[model samples]
Target: MDEAARRRWHQQHSGSWLQLVATLRNEGWEAQVTCEAAPVQVEGTLPSGERFYFRARHSDVSLGIGGDDPADIAEWEASESHQEASYLPAAVGEAMIRRLARRYLEER
Candidate 1:
């Protein structure tokens, strides 16, 4: 994504993340999201006491599940980081994040 596109994607993705916080909370998880800045972050605690954490900046995302287990943590970013990952088109990156978030919530 070019600078303009990246900015757009960041805004769009950040908005989507914001919208998710409410739905997630309704699912019995205390999903709180902070997307006002780049590298939006979200952390939640499931009703079962399981912890969930998510961080996304542009097309790159890192997730933590199962608490403190290194094996349970994963990062997926086609471009690696903000500078390198800017190549991902906004639509593609947005779709990826949506899918990933859905799966995470469903599994939880």
Candidate 2:
């Protein structure tokens, strides 16, 4: 994507993540965010009692959120945690959040 498209993508993706965090917090769940240099980390417990950690790059804006399983959480932590790439489309980001929310809520 071009510069403008990239900026829009990042804005949408980051905004959605922020919204999700806020929603979770509003529901009385504990959420924490650490905006570091490259990979911005948002780790918290969902209302369903499952813990999740989302990691995304601020530059390229590629993001992934999944950590309910202990093994998955360990793997996520072991990974490079810094994959800079093109920003994902807003639709893609929203779809990811929807899928995660559905999975999280369904398990409750």
Top candidate (TM-score): 1
Q: Which residue pairs of candidate 1 clash?
A: 1-86, 79-85
The reply for model 1, stretches above 4 Å from the true place, is 1-16, 68-108
Compose the digit string of candidate 1's lDDT tens values, residues 1-108. 699997987777666666666766776777676443455566766556656565556656655655463124533212224442333333443455456556666764
Error (Å) of candidate 1 at residue 52 is: 1.5
Per-residue CA lDDT of model 2 for 1-108, tens digit only, reads 899997876676777657756775897666765542244555666565656665545433322334555224422232222234234333444455455556545544
- True-vs-predicted CA distance for residue 71, candidate 2, Å: 9.2
Q: Give candidates' CA RMSD values in order.
A: 6.7, 6.9
TM-score of each predicted structure versus truth: 0.47, 0.43
TM-score of 1: 0.47
Clashing pairs in 2: none
User: What C-alpha lDDT values do all the predictions have?
Assistant: 0.55, 0.50
